[model samples]
Target: MKKAWIIWLASTLLLAAALHVAFMFAYPYILMNAAMDRLSANGERENVWTHAPRMTETARLIVRPSPDLAYSSCVYDLSDGPVQISVQPWGDYMSLSLFGANTDNYFTLNDRRMPESGAIVILRTADQAITDEQRAAAFEVVDSPSARGIALVRRLAPSPERFAEAEAARVQEECRALNAE
Candidate 1:
């Protein structure tokens, strides 16, 4: 009876371990897909920035969104080619962050680190090639572990008045296919 009970306990632990590992691997992908779907629900195309209104109590598009920050997001799909992202600085604090499909934040650039002209980044898949022209351009090139990911911009807007300035800065932000032109 003692041996049988020990075996049962071991089996239960193994099953629990397997389940935990599975959930860890799957949750991020599931969450990211849902976020993408919600972001594009309005017939918005990929590689285009969608500006979100100031965060209110009803805002639920993102988990734990900051009420003091304005957000703009782009669901990037790089299967066809590279995408170009431009962010204009606004307020005292602004940041651009890139997240992989698995919810890993692989890149982040803040306004303090950005040039006075703003930030221009080219995001491409690992297999994609960068042309000589792109390499020579002033923009920085980054590699995406997955073809699909999210680019998010956050600008500090502590008040309703500052939120309007954040919105104006978001208007100058751009996310588009590099080859579109």
Candidate 2:
């Protein structure tokens, strides 16, 4: 009876460990899918920037959003083709970050690293071939691990006045499929 009880306890622990590992591996993908669905719910096309209004207590688009920052998000689907992203500099603090389908942030550019003219990047899947035109465009090319992902832009707007400026500057930010135009 003692040996049987010990074996049962060990089996239960192993099952729990496996379950935990599975959840850990799946949670990021699950969260990202939900976010993508929400972002695209309005029949908006992919690779278009969606500028989010300043985070308010009522805003729930993102988990624990900072009320002081202005945010924009783009749900990119590179299956059709590579996408071009352009982020316009705003204020003293601004950043652009790219995350894969699994929520892995593979690239980030901040104001300090960006040029005065702003930053432009082309995102393509590893298997996608870069065209001569694209190569000659003199833009930074990034190989995405997954064909679908998210690009997020953040700008510090700690005050209402600064938030207004951030909102205005966000107009210049853009993301679009390279083949579209």
The lDDT per prediction is 0.89, 0.87
Tens-digit per-residue lDDT, 69-169, candidate 2: 88999999998999999888775888999999999999998999888888789899988887888766735899999988899999999899998898888
Clashes by residue pair, model 2: none
Clash count (model 1, backbone only)? 0
User: Which parts of model 2 have CA positions greater than 4 angstroms off?
Assistant: 1-17
Top candidate (lDDT): 1
**Cα-based lDDT at residue 37, candidate 1:** 75
lDDT of 1 by residue, 1-181 (tens): 9999999999999999999999999999999988887886743668999999999999999889999998999999999999999998664899999999998999999988898878789999988988888766735899999988899998889899999988888898889999896
The lDDT of model 2 is: 0.87
The C-alpha stretches of model 1 lying farther than 4 A from their native spots are: 1-16
lDDT of 1 at 121: 94
**lDDT for position 26 in model 2:** 95
